[model samples]
Target: MNTLLLRPDPGHEKFGLGPFFRVEPLGLEYIGAALLAAGYPVTVADLRFRPGATAWVRRTTPRIVGISCLHALEYDRIIATAAEVRRAAPNAFIIVGGHAAASYPAPLEHDLIDAICLDDGEEVLPALAKAIKKGLPLTEVPALRLKTDHGWVTTQPLPERTSLDLIRLPARHLVERHRSGYHCLLFKPVWLVETARGCPHRCSFCSVWQFYGRTCRERSLAAVVEDFATAGDSIFVADDLFWYDPERSMELAAALKKRGVFKRWILVQTRTDLITKRAEVMAAWRPLAKDFDIFLGLEAASDSGLEGITKDSEVTDSVEAVRLARELRYGINGNFLVDHNWGEAEFQELWDFVARHGLQRAGFTVLTPLPGTEFYEGIKARIPDQPWSNFDMHHLLWEPKLGAQRFFELYAETWKRSILNTSGEKSLLDWVRQVKPSQWPYIIRVLWQTQRMMKPDAYMTEHALSRAPLPEPAARQPGAIVRDEGGQP
Candidate 1:
């Protein structure tokens, strides 16, 4: 049986951005490779890179078509693409998987999608492929949900692969040609590598641990180094949580050094607690930084805000990490989530924290209740709209304790104020002029993007006016439930 894997373009145009492309759909590539290895004809098409995606799907008419929905932001595009696929291949089985599908099963139950794969698609896809090839009933396939006679029926859960080493390094050859499109720190061609999967931390707002399990899993050092060698100079380890295991991190660093993979800059994401406790470990792993920068998620500015988000690190640890990164001369990108529970005063405190830490390159996102996360479960009833696209980090989906419009307005203002305040004492344009010649284009683009974002017209036009009232959620009495140190339920 012929199977075609489709990953739809993110439709950046709809989001008011130019056409942006992904290096390759690593998740889809893995599932494709597994199917191919099992002696089935498999073709992978990443519509993000390829133009005329629907036409291409029509041309490559296969018995089954699968699309990966990694981000909630791409929900509209994914569903639309699936509808096109169904039209193109009427008899074809349409399957949707990845983060979005696993998180929000109800969304995928529309007429466009025939089956939804929950959790990891690695083992699930192979079983699905075999079932399709043999004309076996799909209802028997584990880790899959099918539109049945009654309603959506889910099979037994697919076992999560504990041994990362057993899984082949995702089809690197299939992605190698498009490597330049996927860059680290944006704009630069960088290879994306995942040395690990899942997170050990139990942050309430995150769905990663829930999807990939709480225990961290590691890819073999040799396999990682091999992939790194193919990745050329720069590498971005896209692990949900790096540095969860100090020994594994050190071993990987040593392997990179030994294999001469340290030539290009390395970018990684980790928690503040890990960085604070393992400062020496970070120092020891410095060889990995010969070309390495770090990104740490500082969810909120105050401990109360942090506690609300259930981030393991305190505000102090965030400050220390920034200071250490500055001392080490590592490129640091700190990510902060503007909590819905925060009012204007809390927002100012966040900005003050960033200014105080001297963190220049920072990412600020409005807290979104992504499906499958504890955050979503806690606030689903209070969500005014179920529009998946609005769940993108940029938009506010739920009715915040504060007014939603005010929350968004404050968020946009805070970002502008932070950027202008932090990028030297000069004005926005003045800061752009001061940027190095090589970095001029990027800086200008960022400035333009920020200006566009800050414009009152853009904010008012994109977001809904007059906040939609959500169903009143059951109130939680004070001290009704006690949370652990991590604030996880």
Candidate 2:
């Protein structure tokens, strides 16, 4: 059996944090590993680089093609890539899977796609390939939404959650050619390592918990230690919750130290409450890297705001976490959600909070009702014709209470308060000096591209171009008090 896995060029990466991060497709690498172990020849191509899917398909001539859809914003690009693959390899059984595809697959249920993997690909893809090789009915394969004469219908669910130990090591060799292209901020050639999967917390704005059913699964200590030992010096841990289990995290830190594993830089995401409650665990892991940064889910500025979104943690937790992490010498970079229903007062409150805590590193995003969440289910009917590209959290799906223009004015001002605003506290030249002369070109290019986020006109243009006409009631009744969905007004 021959297999081809692709990480498509997500077309909507020109805005927000897109330029700041571009790591390898760790999911496809793991799936490719499983296929290789099962005696299938595999080729992993990141279509973000030169030579698109058509070129790879012509060269590899694969029997099966798998495409990843990690974010909802990439839905359009994924479909276009699938069409291109179909043209190049008409006989290939095309399957799509990843966070977005598996969560709400309705958008990807097209004639070009043969099936969608609704679960972990490491187990599902190998099993799917085996059935295809044997000419067996794909309906027998578990965890798939298979295409049939009738229509797209899901097959049986996996007997149990796939173990993290399914593949001893990811098939990173497949993506080695594009290693230097992978990065997070100034860390070129960075490695993405996953010590765990799934998040236990249920933040209403997030889809991770809803998709994974609030279950947290960790890899074996030995496996994690081995991964860290062999990986590059700069690593970004892909865990949704880095310290969900304090004891296991502490043990993992100890195991890495025992194996003599250290890094130049490491970045991980976790909740402020987790940091405040599990201070000892965080302390234990701080020494793993010379430059350790923690990305906290600082979702709100006040207790009422946090409660409205069901974050379950208080604003005090965020304050304390920032204090504690800085005390421990861990660089802090977090984000806060700016609600569409917010007024001038609300925006000012967030600004005051950021200034008070000295959190210029924190980023801001509009409160988007992402697919695969309860929030999206409640609000999808309101905006039926909006393009998926606008779901990037930078664009508003519906007109806000303050209207698009004023909302973007305040939104852009909020961004100016952050360190990303080159015209603000940090000059473009200062950012250039931080990196080596060789990296200046890359740094300047990324910083210049990021300036679009600071322009209200840029967002307004994109919003008008991508959005459909507003609903009749909302349009007829301007300046009406629109109740906020999934949060307080």
Candidate 3:
């Protein structure tokens, strides 16, 4: 039996350009690699890199077509692409998985998608292929949602893979086949690798814990090093919290060094608390630091706002992490969740903090209550809109405690202030200076991109607020309607 794994094109929208704009569909790669390891013929197509995906689908012709829906914004496009694929391959089994599908299985249970993989697809996908090869009904597979006579029938949970080391490195052949015109940051070909799954921290605003569960899982050091070897010059470890285990991180770093994979730069994300407590561990792994960039989620400026989001990392801890990263001479990037509950004063506080710490290469996202998160449940009673696209965190979906217009204005103003701050600019220059002078062109390109993002008028005009009135909570659908075992509805 032949199987084709598809990653739907994430439609053109916010930040859909530059290094950050690249689509690295590691989920589809994981499932495809697993199926291939089991001796099943597999083809993977990332729609983002494919022109006229519907036309490409008509050409591939496979028995089973699996589409990954990584982000909610890609829902409309996925549905349309699935419909087109069904038309081309009438007998094809269309399967949908990923964060969006895992969160909201009920809505996607319609005729467009034949089967939904609820949890990890690495194990389930191979079993699905075997069952198909043997001409067995898909209902026998665990962690699957399929259409029954009545409606959707979901099977018992597929047991999570106990050993992360068992999963193979993603099928690089698939990535290369469709990689002629791909985008990456810094002009270098970039590939994504996963060191672990699930996050140990339970940040209230994040849906990772809800989807992947709370416990952290790590791949064997040898397994991770082997995977890193297959990637390109740059690798992004797409773990929710990369350094959750300092000992494991050090061991992995040493292993990478031993295997010579440390020569390629690696980017990873971690919490502020981890960075502070593990500075020595990070220093021990300094051989890899020149090629390493770390992203920290310092969500809020004030402790009250931090508590609201259940980010236990104190403001002091965040500042310390920034200081430590600078001392260790590592590229540092941060993402801050601007609370809508704050007025001008709070926005000023955030700007002041950023300037004081010289955090230039940072992202400022509006505090959106994304579906399947505790924050979403807490604010369901007062949410103002159903514009799902606005849930992208770039737009303000709720009627802010400070009111909508002011919220947007303050957000725009804060972005401008943070960009123009002298201290922030100097700090970025310090980082650039650490790199070889020959790489200045690439560094300048990224800086230009950052400046474009910082432009107030450009961003405001592009992501402007609609003048429509806010919707009443009573008029909105209940939260349960949009939620399922996998994740958001």
lDDT computed for candidate 2: 0.89
Candidate 3: regions farther than 4 A off: 16-19, 178-184, 380-385, 418-469, 472-489
lDDT of 2 by residue, 1-489 (tens): 679999999978767888889999999999989988888899999998989999999999999999999999888889999999999999999999999999989999999999999998998988888999898999999999999999888999999989897665888999999999998998998999999999987887788999999998889999989888998999999999899998898889999999988899999999999999989998999998999998888988877788767888999999999999999999999898887777788899899999999999988988888999888887788889888898898988777878889999999999999999999999999899888898888999999999998999999888779648865323311112123544342
Question: Which order, best to worst by lDDT?
Answer: 2, 3, 1
Give the alpha-carbon lDDT of every model: 0.70, 0.89, 0.70
* Clash-forming residue pairs, model 2: none
Candidate number with greatest TM-score: 2
- Give lDDT tens digits, candidate 3, residues 285-347: 667634678878988776666665667778888888888877887778788877655656767
Q: What TM-score fits each model?
A: 0.87, 0.97, 0.86
* TM-score for predicted model 2 compared with the true structure: 0.97
The candidate that achieves the highest lDDT relative to the unseen native structure? 2
Pick by lDDT: 1 or 2, better one: 2
* Residue pairs in candidate 3 whose N, alpha carbon or C atoms collide under 3 angstroms: 102-486, 102-487, 103-486, 103-487, 103-488, 482-489
